[model samples]
Each structure stands twice: as structure tokens, then as C-alpha cells.
Target chain A: MPPRSAPDRLLAVLDAFDHDHPALTLTDISRRAGLPLTTAHRLVGALTAWGALERDPSGVYHVGLRLWEVSALAPRGLALRQAALPFLEDLYEATHENVQLAVRDGAEVVYIEWISGRSAVGVRIRVGARWPLHATGVGLALLAHTDPEFQAAYCTGPLPAFTAHTVTDPALLRRMLAEVRRTGCAVSVRQITDDALSVAAPVRGAGGAVAAAVSVVVPADGIQVPALIPAVRLAARGISRRLGWRPA
Target chain B: MPPRSAPDRLLAVLDAFDHDHPALTLTDISRRAGLPLTTAHRLVGALTAWGALERDPSGVYHVGLRLWEVSALAPRGLALRQAALPFLEDLYEATHENVQLAVRDGAEVVYIEWISGRSAVGVRIRVGARWPLHATGVGLALLAHTDPEFQAAYCTGPLPAFTAHTVTDPALLRRMLAEVRRTGCAVSVRQITDDALSVAAPVRGAGGAVAAAVSVVVPADGIQVPALIPAVRLAARGISRRLGWRPA
Candidate 1:
């Protein structure tokens, strides 16, 4: 392979950080980025000077506030979350459950915002968490609205199951996606966790396309799935409206 | 001046984006970054491929989701806000007021989280928004907890008044900060806006140093400063404990 360019080398230093290894030493970054120690030191110094990475007193490096400030401009990230927060808050108030807003990223759903309700059922979801498209309500809602060819390919792809209830059969998952499109919502029962059920609805963007999904998770046992559908749809519609979506 | 390094050239491409210029064309970026069009194109291409920036259908560029995902690891940003959210939600639920969490950056406060109450008084604040240290309650709370020498220097700096009620005199500002330290809360009455009053308390980290501030903003008229004091302080302490702080 050819030698990495300067831009690639710099980006590699940033790529050394992730959800799991958020903090790292210079040696860790050098090893992770596959760069020489001297090169890593120079690049890290530049990144720290530019405020993309910060070094703590102990010499450990982590992502910095300036990066967060810049990333806040991502329309599919914090910008979307900021627009949807008030409606999410309203939904949280109405249901007192774990509310989430997520967008489709490849074959997975990336949760951008999450509001945990006091006394709500415990769900393994947080901001920046990811779940497969066939394994959660928000994922299904987003996948259901994608291009037919993309959806078809995803349906035929390997569907990892978190719980036995997670949909694994391509035909059954396709049918569920059909139902989601027809009913304007998706109900994922014990898909991610054994005891949680999520009801979700698609949020549209200004161009009449599904841009994101909003959902609420509750205990699977004694869940009022029917009662949740409308509330979830309303919040989705509220966020869609805020995003400049208009219904015909 | 020394010639710019490769990393500086790349960071300048990112620095072209801000709250005001979230979206930009290649030419805009080239101009803003003070780079030649060809150089900007190459850097932008690298950034896009690395998922730090994204190009829209219209050929405009934006901060991307990958950057947001990486920035989520910022301890001073989302990590702090995540640890503080439950307390902020409880505060919002208890008072139905606009809740804010901010950290001091130099002589300014950067709001990392904000939950706007539907019926709460409108305050000109948003996530990632900044205000001077003396013009907001969270700013004052954070400022009062800094090293005495730093605090003294900041107090003596120019205090630009927002509203007529903003503290402009260095001596008065010093007294106010002392009171904040003594009472463990900062109450700024109509400092930011004529109709808004904010009560803030500092949150400590594991090392017993103030890391952030949590505040609730209400209308200036008919405000109960005393009633809000304990509630705000409680929330701050709760977040501090969650962050591994222990009472001395």
C-alpha cells in the first residue's frame, strides 16, 4: 500500500479515539494509528493546539470541547436532536418512559438523543449508542422508510439477534417493515432486551423523506402498545414539522 | 511568521465552520480557511473520506455524524452532561423552569446542556452558546470556584453589561463572587435579560474541584430566590456525587 498522506495521518490520530477507548496515552495513539512515535507526538501536539484533543494533567488525551462545539453543527447529530428535544420532552412527560431519537446510519440506527424517565423500565440505550436495523423499534421505523432496494438488501442481510424475540427471518422482517410503512409506526417487542418493548414512528425531513425516528421503551409485560402508537406518532410529527416537513 | 504546517492547514478547514457558518460551499471554506481552492478541495476530500465532514446533495459541506460520535467522548462535554442529566430532569420536573448546565472556558461560560420548560420565561441561551463570566448565574458560580488568583484577574477584567442590572463594577462583582462562594450558589437577577433571573450552583469533580455549574432560570418578577437555592444546590451536589465527588 502507498504511504498515508498528511491528512490521513492526522485523521488516523483522531480515529484512535472511540466510545470504548475515549482516553489514551501518546503511545496508545501511536500504536492505534500505526504511526511512528515521533510523528504521533507532532500530530497530537497539533491536534491539541487546534483544540480537537485535550491533554489532562496526567498526560492522558481525550476528545476536547472544541470538537464537540464543531460537531454540534452536524445536522444529523445535535442539530436534529436540538430540534426534536422539546417534542421528545413532551413525549417523555406524556409516557414517563425512556424516549429516544435516532437516525439510520448504514444498516444500524444511531441514537442521537435519549431521555430516561424516572421509574421507567431499564433499557440499554444512550446517546451515541447503535443497534442493528432489525433489532429495535427506531431502527425498524427508519429502515421501513428507506429506498426499497436498500431495505430489501438489508432484509436479506444477516440479522443479529440480541434476544430470542428479535426478528431474524428475512420474510418476517420484510412483513414487519411493510406493516410499519402501512401503519405509520413500528412496534418492537423484546427485540433488544428481554423485558423491554419499544414503539416508534418515523420523522420526516423537509423534502418528504424519513430523516429520523422517535420511540419510547417500556416494560414488555403489561405494555399498552396500542396506547403508545399515537403518542409516538404525534411526537414524530411534531419533530418533522420542526424540521420543515409538510404533509400533503 | 513560520509557514503553516500540514495539520494547521487541515484544522483551518474545520475552523471555517462555526455557529454562524454551519454549512459552506468549497469556495466558502477556501476563503474562510485562507487556503487556495485546490488545497481546500484536497483537505475537504480527505476530511469527507475520514467522516469528519460530509457533503450534501447540493455540494455544501457540513460537520458529520462520525465527528459527533467521536466528540461524544468529551468528558467536559457530553460525558459531564450525561452524568448530570438525571439531576437536571429532576430539577426541571420539580420547578418547571429552564434548566442549564455550563462550564467555564477562559472568562466565558459554555452551556453544554439546556432543557427549556414549556411555560418558563424565555432566556437567550442554547447548548454550545457562550456568555461572559459576570453576566450569567452559571458563569458566576463557576467563576467563584476557580483558583483565587484566576478569579481575581477575571473580576478585574472588563465586565460588559448585558442589561442594566448586570454587574459592571469590579468591586461589586468581587463581592458578588464572594457571596456565591459563601452561600454555595449564585443568583443573578436580571443580569442576562430584563425578565430573567437565574440561580446557579457549582458541581465538583472527584478531586473536589468545581467542574461545572447547574442553574435554573425563571422570570425576574415574582421569583422566589430562597426557594430555588436549595433545589439548585441539591441538583449540583447530586451531579457532583455521581461524578465521584465526596464531601470532605
Candidate 2:
């Protein structure tokens, strides 16, 4: 293949970082990005100078505050989270559980915001983390609102299962999607982690398109599903309204 | 001047979008970045394809979710906010007011997280916004903890005043900084806005250095400074502890 574009090379350097590797040395970046050490050095210098990356006093590189400042402009990132925060806070208050706001990207759901009370059930979700669109409550809520053709194609997959309750069969997933749409909310019971359950609802955007999903995660064994549905849906609707969504 | 670097030109495209200019067309970017239309188009295309920039149906460009995902790795940004969210939540729950987490970036404090109750006093602040290090309560808290030399230089400044109550005199600012250190908190009354007051405290990191600051914003009228100071300081201490800080 031809040489990578300048943008690709720069992005590859950034792609080297993740939740597990937020900090890296120059050599690690070079190796992970598959760039020559010299090339990595030059690109890292450029990035550091541009304030896209920061080099700590210890010489480790980190994604910089400037980059975060720019990224805060992302409509689906800080902007969306900002619009949804009050409602998310309300949901947290009502349920006293973990609350999340996520948007679907391809076949995955990327969490944009998360809030868990001090005594809330412990879950591994973090902002910017991605999970398959068929596994989580937010995923199910978002997936259930997609175009039927796209939904059908998505369900025909080799779905990965995290727990015994995860719906791996396409047929069952399709039926569940239909149910999610019919009921106006999705309930994911021990689908991701066996100890947790999530109740979610779709959020609409300015044009009334399903733009995101909101959910509450709680302990699986003693969840009050009946009580949670309205609270979750109310928060989703509140966020949707904040985003200029209006029901027809 | 030497020819602009490829990465710089690409970054220029991104820099064209700011708070007031979140959406731009190709021509708009070209003019803002001082590049020819063709060059701007090429860079915009590369950025869009790489998922750094997004082009909407209306042909306007926006910062994309992918960039937000990458920026979430910034230790001073989302990562720090995530770590402090629990404490911030508690502070909000107790006060039912605006809570903020900020870190000093150069001479400014960049707000990384914010939580305001729906009926909270309307203080103008959003995530990723910045303010000078001597005006806001969070800024004063962060500024008070920096090295003496840095603090001295910052205090010798061209401090901008937002309201009549803003402490613009260098000597007065110095005295305030000393007081912040002595009291373990900073209180600003109508510093940025006429009707707002803020109380802030520094949050120490694992190395026992002040890493970030947390604050509560409330209405200036009928304010109880003594009552709020301890709550704000407690939230800051709680976050600092969660970050592995211990009393020296």
C-alpha cells in the first residue's frame, strides 16, 4: 500500500493511547504507532507544540488539555453531555443508581456521560468507553430505534456474549428490539454483567431522530423494574427536549 | 516565515472552530486559517475521513465524537473530571448549587466538569471553558498553590476585571492569594458576574501536590460564606483523597 497520509500518521500517534495506556513514553508511541522512532519524535514534537499532546516532567506523553478543549465542541460529546447533565443528575437523584448517556456509533454505543451516586452499584462503565450495540440497555434502546433494514443487518451477526443472558441469537435479538420499540424502553437484565441490570430509553434530537440513549444501572437481583421505567424514560425525554426534540 | 507544517495546517482547520464558530463551511475555514480554499478543502477532507472533523448534511464542519473519544484520555480533562465527579455530585447534592472542577492550564483555569441544579443561580460557565487564574474562586485556589515564583509573576499582572468587585490590584490579589492558602479555600464575591459568588478549594493528587480545584457557585445575595466554605473544602478534600492524597 502507499505511504500513510500525514493526517493518518499524526492520528496513529494519538490512537496509541487508550483507557489502559493514557500515558506513554516516546518509544512506546513509536512502537505502538508502527512509526520509526525519529518519525515518532518529530510528530510527537509537533503534537506537543500544538498542545494536542502534553509531555509530563517525567517525559511521558498525555492527551493534552488543549485537545480536550477542542473536543468539547463535539456535538455528541461535551455539548450533548452538557445539555443532558441536569436530567442525568435528576435521574441519579431519583434512582440513586448509575446513570449514563450514550450515542450509537456504527454497531457500538459510546458513553458520553456517566454519573453514579456514592452508594450506587459498581459498574465498569466510563465516559468514551464503547460497548457493542446489542448488549447494553442504551444499546438496545438505540438499536431498537434504527431503521428496520439497518437493524436487520445488525442482528445477523456473530454477536459476542458477555453473560449467559446476553442475546446472541439474531432471532431473539430481533424480537427483543421489537419489544423495546413497542414498550418505549429497553430493559437489559444481566446482559453485560451478571450482577447488574439496566433500564434505558431512546433520546431524540432536534429533528426528532433518535440521537442518543439514557439509562440507569442497578443491582440485578432486587431491581424495581416497574418503577425505573418511567424515571429513565422521563430523563431521556427531558434530554431529548433539551436537544430540541419534539414528539410529533 | 517557513512554510507551515502539514500538521499545523490541519490543526488550523480545527482551530477555526471555537465557541462562537462551532460550524464552518470550507470557505470559512480557508479564510479563518489563512489558507487557500483548495488547501483547506484537502485538510478538511483528511480530517473528516479520519473522524477528527465531521461534515453535516448542510455542508458545515464540526468537531467529531471520535476526537472527543481521544481527548477523554487527557488527564486534566475528562479523566480528572471522572475521578472528581463523585465528590462533585455529593457537593451538589448538599448545596443544590453549581459545582465545578478545574485545573490550571498555563495562566488560565480550564473548567473540566460542571454540575448545576436546574433552578441553581444562573452563573455562566460550561465544561471546557477558561477564565484567568485570579478572578474566579477555582482560579484563586489553583493560583494560590503554585510555586512562589510562578505566583509572583502571575500576581504582577494585567488582571482583567469583570465586575467592580473583581480584585484587579496586584497587591490586593497577592493578599487574597495568601489568604486562600491560609484558609484552605478561596471565596470570590461577584468577581465574574454581578450576582454570583464562588467558594473553591484545591484538590491534591497522589503526589500530594494540588492537581485540581473544586468550587461551588451560588447567588451573591443572602449568601452565607462561612457555611459554604467548609462544604466546598470538604468536597475538594474528598476528591483529593480519592486521588490518593494524604495529609502531609
Candidate 3:
């Protein structure tokens, strides 16, 4: 492996953490971060002393509250999530389904907020998890709102499909984006998982630009798209209103 | 200002942003962080490139999505908030007043989550806001659950009073802590604003230790504290259950 710079090395300590690996011991950190034991020891000490990492009674390290405090200031992360939460909660109460808030990060959509919908279709997404732009409902809604040129670029070869219903053809994907723009919403029916369908609407901010997308994950069988559309749109409008978007 | 270490300088740039100054121009960042123009530019460049900060259309810098995504992994921040949110929502829906979740940070309480009531209160607390352990209802609940030696140290003469009703005497504060522990709840009656009162309860973790606190802020006058106690305790109990706490 190529030797990393000081910043990269330090950041790798943090990089060692992920959804599947939230807790790690010093040996795990050394292995995952590709750091020598001594270097890992010093860096981990700095991180723990700085409260970037917390050591539990079991000597396993997890992300600490201090880093989370600093991170809560991210405008597109918790800031946007903060603005979208009441509406998400309202939608969850209405549907009792998985409610999610997502924003685009380059080619992927990162889940900024999620409320587990235990009674409805089971979705495997967790907070901060990500999926491609064409696979999930939130992803399609956000990708649909992007500029046509970027959309064209995104639809080129290498469209990986997760399920049989996922849109893999370029022309079909273009049509889907158009339909999303026209309806002001995107419905991915069993696109991510075989049994789950999602309906998503674009949320606008003060500038009248799409700020985020909200979606509901529901069972694919016996789905009612028409009925779900208005509720999703209403939640989107509520979030948009709170973001300072008003009708002209 | 003294020259800061490279890491500290980077952290200072982050510390430069807070609730009051969520967005900042380069000049604003340098001035607030007390760093020279050249150094601040270089650092901001690194941070933005690292996805720690995002530059807006107006050239204002904000904490970025990457940081927020990483922060969500913090057990004490988003993780704790996620566990407490449903119960907080129920409390908000029932009371129609401000609902908050907070954790103790040293001698103060740092609010990690907040749901603005339909009729918002006058206290003006936002997420990440800090209050002395002696002032806020959540703070009192957390302080009551913390080590007795720490509570004794906090109750010394340096206790600054917010309102006439604030508990300033060490002896009285000790008595208040005892009552909070005994009753399994805390009520800060008009300790913040004269028009405001807060009812808070401590949330226990799987280990049965007080992990956090939840509370509601309502107008001080004519509100029945006895009536609010059960609701607050129930919400706390619900969150505690989510955190893996069980009644013995």
C-alpha cells in the first residue's frame, strides 16, 4: 500500500469506523487503518484525549459525543435534517411506514435521517447509510431533480441493478427522470428490495430549489400509489413551508 | 492570539462556527478564529477539500455533510437522540409544548435534540445549546444522577442565578438533587425565564445508569406540575426502554 500523508493517516483512524464496524479495539484500529502498532497507539491516544474516540469498559473504542457535537453543525446533515424532521415525524405518524430524509452526495444519496417504520415494509437502511442514485426512492427523487446534463452523464454505462424492477436502461432512466419532474415526485416500486416500494417527493427550501427528498418505504404487494402520492406531497409541502418556501 | 497547533488550528476553524454563526465568510472565519489570512485560507482550503466544510453560493462556509454523517455515529449525540426522539415526540404531541433531550457535559448540560412546540416557548434553546447544571430542568435531572462529589463541587458559590427562583444555595441544591433521585423526576419551576417552567426525568441506559434526560418546557403559571410529572416520567421510561433499560 502507498504510504499516506499525516492528514490521511489521522483521518484513517476515523475512517476505520463504519456502519458494520462502529466499535473496534486498538488492534482492530491498527489493522483497519493500516497503521503500525506504535503509531496507532499514539494517534488513538490523541483521539481519545481529544474526545474524538471514547473507550468503553471493555476497551473498545467508539465515536465520542464531542465529535458528534461538532458534526451536528453540518448544514446539509443535521441542519437539513432538523428542518425536515417535524414533517418526517408527521408522515411517519400518518403512514406508520419507514420515513427517510436524504440528500445527494456526488453519485450517491446519503440517508441523513430515518425513522424506522416497524409496522410497514422493512427497509434495511440506517442513518448515514448510502445507496446509488437510481436504486432507492429518495435517490431517484433527488437524481430526478438534478440538471439534465448531469442526469445524462449519470445514465451512461455501468448502471448496477439491485433487483429485477430497478431501472437499468438509459432511455428508460431518462423517461423516469422526466416523469419525476412532471409529477414532482418519484415512485420506485420494488426497486431496491424485491418486496419494498417507495414514494418520494422533492422538498424545496427558501430559494425554491430542491433541498432534500422524503420517502416512505412500504410493502410492494397491494400497493396504492395514487393514495400515497398526496400524503407524500403534503409532507413535502409542509417541509418546504418550514424551509421558507412560499407560493408566489 | 497564540499560535495554535496544526490540529488545534483546524479544530478552531470548526469551533469558529456555532448556532449564532452557522455561516461565515472567509474574513469572518479568520477573525473569529484569530488566525492570519494566509493560514486561515490554507486551513479552510484543506477543510473544504476534506469535506469538513462546504462553501455556499455566497462564499459563506458551513459545516459539511461528511462531518454530519460521521457525527451521527456518536453514541451520545444522534444515537442517544434517536433513542429518545419517539418518546419526545409523544411528549410534544401531548403537551404541545417544547420538548428537549439533553446530556451532561462536565458541569453543564448540552441539549442534543429539540422539538419546537406548536406554541414555541420564550427560552430560545436550540440544539447544541448549553446551560449550567443548576438552571435547566434537564440539567437538574442529569446533575441529580451524576456523582455526588461532582454535584457538591458544582453547588459551590460560583453558581450564577438566572432568575429569582433559581436554586443558588449549595445546601438547597443538594436537597433538590435528593428529591429528584427520590421521586425519579425533576421540575425546574420558573428557574429559567419567569414565565417558563420545565419538567424533566432522567433516562437510564441498559446498565441502569442515567444516560440522558428528557423534558418539556411550558409556561410557568397555572400549569399543574403534578399532572406533568407522570407524562415526563413515562417518556423517560419509554426512552430508557429503547436504550435497553428494564425495570428490575
DockQ, every prediction: 0.84, 0.83, 0.62
**Every candidate's CA RMSD:** 1.8, 1.7, 1.8
lDDT of 1 by residue, B52-150 (tens): 899999999999998999899999998998899889988998999999999988889999999887799999998889999999999999999889999
Off by over 4 Å in 2: none
**Cα displacement (Å) at residue A94, model 1:** 2.6
The CAPRI quality class of candidate 3 comes to medium
Best candidate (score: lDDT): 1
Q: DockQ rank, highest first?
A: 1, 2, 3
Off by over 4 Å in 3: B1-3
TM-score value, chain A, candidate 1: 0.97
Looking at candidate 1, what is the lDDT of residue A233?
99
TM-score, chain B, model 2, is 0.97
Q: Is candidate 1 or candidate 3 better by DockQ?
A: 1
> What lDDT does each candidate get?
0.93, 0.91, 0.86
Candidate 2 falls in which docking quality class? Answer: high
Global lDDT of model 3: 0.86
lDDT of 3 by residue, A1-248 (tens): 99765555667888888878888999999999999989888788877877778999999999987788778788788888888898898898888888999999988999988887557777878889988899888888899888878888998957888889988999998888899999988998877789989999998889988888999888899557778889999999999999899977
User: For candidate 2, lDDT tens digit of each residue in B38-71?
Assistant: 9998888888887889888999999999999999
